[model samples]
Target: MLDFHMVYTCGYWSGSPECGLDDAQQQKLNLVCRNLNLKPGQTVLDILSFAKFAAENAGAKVVGITISKEQAALVRDLCKGLNAEIRFEDYRDTLGEFDHIVSLGMFEHVGPKNYRIYMERISGLLTNGGLFLLHIIGAT
Candidate 1:
C-alpha cells in the first residue's frame, strides 16, 4: 500500500489528510528532518533508510541502518550520489557519533524489555546536545 517512498508507517500529515500519499510521505520525511534541525555536513542517524529527505532537503549526511539486506540495497540505490549511506545490520551493532538521530517505526520492535538498553545505545551514539526523535504508531 505504501509504494510512495515505502514509508511503511503512517504519514506526518499534520492535518493535511487531503494530500496524496506521495505528498504525505514527503511531508513526513521533511517534518522529521526539520524537527531534528539537520544541517549541511552534519551527521544524522536514521533508524530506517529515510535519508533521502534529510540528505537532499537539509543537506545532512545521513547514515541509516536496516536489518533487511534487500531494503538496504534498494535504499542505497535510491540514495545514490547523496550524502546517505545505508547499512544492513542490527541497530545495536551500529557505531559512531551523530549530531542527530531519527527512529521511525522501530521503537515498537525494540520491545519493553530492551527499551532501556535501546535508549542507552542511541544516547551513546548521539553527541552531546544532539537531537533525537522517536516516532511510532500506537495501536491499543
Candidate 2:
C-alpha cells in the first residue's frame, strides 16, 4: 500500500522546506524532468508510474510500466488526457528506444543478481545521447 496521496517514493525536500507532502512530491518530479532536460515530443521510459503524469505535463510522450495490473490501471486513469501510456509489464520485456529513462524506487526489486543485466537492458533501451536517472535506496 502507498500513502493516501498515492506517493509511494521519497520526496525531494531540498527545493522547498515549507512545502507539504504533495508539494514536495511534485517538486521531486519537476526536478527530475528538469535534470533530464526532457523536451516536447521526446519519448521517456519511466520504469515506475510516478513520473508519468508529470512528464506528460511537460509535453513528453511518457511510457510507464509497472508489474502490477492495479497500478497500471490507476496510472492510466490518472494520466487521462495526457500523452502517456501505462502498461502492466516488466522492464525486461520493454522495447523501443527512448530519449530518456527514469527509474525511481524500482532498482531494489532487481536485486544484486540481476543488477548487471538490468543496467545492460536500460542501456540498450536508451538512444544515443539519451539521459538516465536512477533513484534508488542504496545498501548500508
Candidate 3:
C-alpha cells in the first residue's frame, strides 16, 4: 500500500520508463550521483527522501528518513531493490552516521534559523573526508 502510493506520487508512476521521472529531472539526478563518483558498496544517506531515485541510481545502500511516517514507509517500499532503510524522525533527531550524504529538496525546510544546526548534524553524521551534497532551490 505505502509502496504503491510512493511509486505513484513521488513521480514514479508517471510511466516515463526512466525510473518513472521526467528526462530533465532524471538527468539532473543522475548527473549529481555520477559527479559524486560513489563507490559500489558505499552507504548513502538520503535526507528527506522522496522516491529513493537518487539513492537507487547511486548503486549504494540507502538510509532514508522523513518527518512523516507515511513518507518513510513509502520510500522503504519503493526502494525494495536497493539496500534501503527508512525511518520516521525529524532530520535533527536522526543520529546514525554514514559514508556519504545526499540531501535533495530538503534545505528549504531548514530555514535560516536552522541551517547551521542542520549542517552541523550532517557534518557529525559523515565520516571524516566523506562527501556531502546539498541540493536546494534558490529564491527568486
Candidate 1's displacement at residue 86, Å, is 1.1
Error of 2 at 113 (Å): 0.5
Residues 41-125, model 2: lDDT tens digits:
9999988745455555579888999999998888888788888888888998999999999998889889999999999999999
Alpha-carbon RMSD to native, per candidate: 1.6, 2.0, 5.2
Report lDDT (Cα) of residue 93, candidate 1: 96
Name the lDDT value of residue 70 in candidate 3: 79
Top candidate on lDDT is 1
1-140 per-residue lDDT for model 1 (tens digits) = 37467667777565765787777778888788778777799999989847776787889899989998898998898899999989997888999999999888889888889999999999999999999999887777
Model 3 Cα lDDT, one tens digit per residue, 22-79:
5445555555567677766687777754337655665677777788777777667677
- Model 1 TM-score, 2 decimals: 0.91
| Steric clash pairs (candidate 3) | none
Q: Could you estimate the TM-score for every candidate?
A: 0.91, 0.90, 0.78
Ranking by TM-score: 1, 2, 3
Global lDDT of model 1: 0.84
User: CA lDDT, every prediction?
Assistant: 0.84, 0.81, 0.68
List ranges where model 1 is wrong by over 4 Å.
1-3, 14-17
